[model samples]
Target: MDRGERFDRLRLARTERVGPVAFDQLVKRFGSAGAALEALPHLARRGGADGFSIPPEHTINAELEAGEALGARLLVLGDDGFPPQLAALDPPPPVLWTLGDPGLLSKNACAVVGARIASSAGLRFARGLAAELGQAGLTVTSGMARGIDGAAHEGALPTGTVAVLAGGIDDVYPPEHDNLWGRIREGGCIVSEQAPGVRAKAHDFPRRNRIISGLSRAVVVVEAELRSGSLITARLAAEQGREVLAVPGSPLEPRAKGTNDLIRQGAALCEGAEDVLRALAAPRTLREPDGRWDGAVPDDEVDAVRDRVLALLSPTAIPRDELARGVGAPAAVVFAALVELALAGEAELLPGGMVCRS
Candidate 1:
């Protein structure tokens, strides 16, 4: 798009309650982010958000300047050189800030992730697996946390690696990774959806995991506990239609539970590079058609569905399709009302067709 439109996209992304799904709805409905920005206030007002506010233009300008100052590039959704794998996400992240060779973002990639507090064997396995994957010409992707993630990047560094961070492209947590971070900035790539200098919050890790898995053709869990971020990434990769692979670990080890459970649930067993290659070669389930209407949506249709949609929703997330069925409305109209509700800070639209109370 044009310069003005690019600025508005960043602004809308930074706006409160305008997440990936809402961003998609607004841009698709209004035709462009510039138009979306122009209509945002009225839309929120109709949804009962009288105090809705847009992030200031100067704030967006400052963020752009910060990115430029760091020599980092901003890859907006739909921009040339934006990774097609990432862009294909149902509602892709609005922007990615990158440091180092941004070329890695679009490379043939597989994720290697496990526990941050990992066993030496797990770390060694992760490093070797990453190295083999790299030598086979696939770039390895990881979250750049301690243990397995750091080992994965280390092993793959000479070939290619991409670090998807929870913090800003510049914010390196677990401070000891400063050396590794520098190596990545020089020879690999560092990327995040957060702005420059933004420290990672607890909530950001799950969001960051989606990008790690989304950028890859498949995800491999080396070792993990019953509850860990690695499994979250695995689930997201599976949901996104990427191959899910897990290393079989000794049942005696506590960290093996998650990967073992993944295997039990039918994730392919990943023993070596060949298994990964074979898994990638396997056919995947076909994605469903992205249903949409042939013509403009009516304001009255949106109004008709709003209250029923509200009554059906609670803090627990429900599928958007269920909402449509519950309200006896067309999916398009229910989605429209949902978007308006999201704008009003009344709901949250999440990945994999989920919607929940704000």
Candidate 2:
């Protein structure tokens, strides 16, 4: 894609109410960012937008300029250097604003997520595991927060690492990690789905977690509470078919409950990097670049099927297979419809593709 096309893509992504899924569907159907930008307002209106508007051109332009001024650049999904694993996601972000060496994205990677207030043992384990993974030529990725996340990045720093920021790539949150953020920017990679000037909102953290999981072949949770963001990332990793490994923590520690629960629910138990490596050694489980888009439905047929599926959904969530049967549509068509409905903000695709009127 050319600069103008990328600019248009960014503009579409920055538009209000245009989430990742919608942006991707529009791009796939239109075959160009320019066309998608042209189509968005009409699509929104049809999908029940009272007033839809794309983000102003100058807003996007200024975002790009801000990034450039900070020595960062916007990296659209499918761009030459975007992470292959991330590109394979069902609805990858249209673009990621990045700083430092985006080249680190190409390296084999694993994610380590855990509590910001992790115990001393958990932090020690994270650092040791990260170093071992780094020694094996895997680039350890983390959120670069405090505790386990910080330890993971610091351990992998001598080799390589990647930090997926919840805020803009240029905006280092927590303030105290300023020096650590600088180190990663110089020697590793920092990425964010939001534009450069966007502040990290509460909702942005889960979105940030997905990228941390998506960029890696596997995700390791060092310590996490039941409601922790790290657990959310682990669930997303599992849904993505990426290996999820969790270090067993004592039952007494509330922070360990999430990881232990994951282990009980069939997530791999990781004592160390060797266990993770062994699990990854299985022939067909690790994601192959060639297989990323192997089974995706073709773009041409999505919209027609999407229209049919929307009519089946109601305010209550319904099982996809049941909806497919009720609507007398093929499973794939129902799947595409749910995806489109999700993109259009007419429906929500819950875990298991359960569709609900939105």
Candidate 3:
């Protein structure tokens, strides 16, 4: 939590090819980010990456300085200020930059997400639902997007709301939400996994959505198309063991397809705050991760297992256990090879212990 270790963690997270899963693995393997930094290059070489790079100390210093200049706080993984809900995730985010009251994240919260081009009725419903939930002492979390997402925050502003962004904490998307972004930064909270001054790409939204669900007790979907990003948030929420609720819409409405399907597949029906409340009262069902690859793999087994894991890997994601079965290696040694391959950029390390070719 001190300055030096914090700097090391930021640098490690910013390092190329190190996603959340690999980040957790490397830290657990070496015991700390500072020690992990020392071993990253050697590990990458074992995975067939010849020239891996770590961000320079000066670069991390500049990033920290930029965040400080904006009056933002950096909450790296393992920091006491990092929300316990997020830390409890299968592979928690390695870094989060916050621009307002970070305390709100630790409080009970629920996510209200939906389509950007939502119907007027849907937007109104989302706003009212958010206000009711906020009055019930739950912080409303959303992406600060237009339509349903924007409306939810407006209704919750007086109570409490947290906006998770795909870009930097200061990078306002939709260009028009400049005012909304400022209000959230001052009155509520603004959060992101990206560094300062970074603009968002299309791929970044999924990662941003992951944080929204991770920080929430449950995710409530409003109007969303069959393939909308809100559906993605609902899926991530379920995968993370958080309850999922959807506000049903008229069957004739195109936006209702996703939520209707979710309900069909067993998502709770959200008529109002009461429905969400009921789901919250139930005990959570997050499966404790078992058969973790915590210990080290001997150098002798590295090349063989790494090659086998690579051969079995394709674009199709497979659970680590299944990968282990295919490679015929102990789960520990197989995962160790995966960590290295992840760092080398040959394999992708996904949440829920799923991996595939990068």
Q: lDDT tens string, model 1, 1-50?
A: 78888888889899988988888778888888888898888889878897
Decoy 2 TM-score against native:
0.88
lDDT preference between candidates 1 and 3, better one: 3
Model 3, residue 92: distance off in Å is 0.3
Candidate 1: stretches off by over 4 Å? 285-289, 293-296
lDDT of 2 by residue, 260-332 (tens): 9999999999999998898788754533232221233654555556666777778998876688788775666
Model 3 clash pairs?
none
- In lDDT terms, which candidate is top? 3
What lDDT tens digits, residue by residue, belong to model 3 across residues 163-249?
A: 999999989988999999989888899999999999999999999999999999999999899989999999999988999999898
- Against the reference, the lDDT scores of all candidates come to 0.90, 0.81, 0.92
Clashing pairs in 1: none
- Candidate 2 segments exceeding 4 Å error: 285-322, 330-345, 348-355
Indicate the worst ten consecutive residues by lDDT in candidate 1: 286-295
Error of 3 at 126 (Å): 0.7
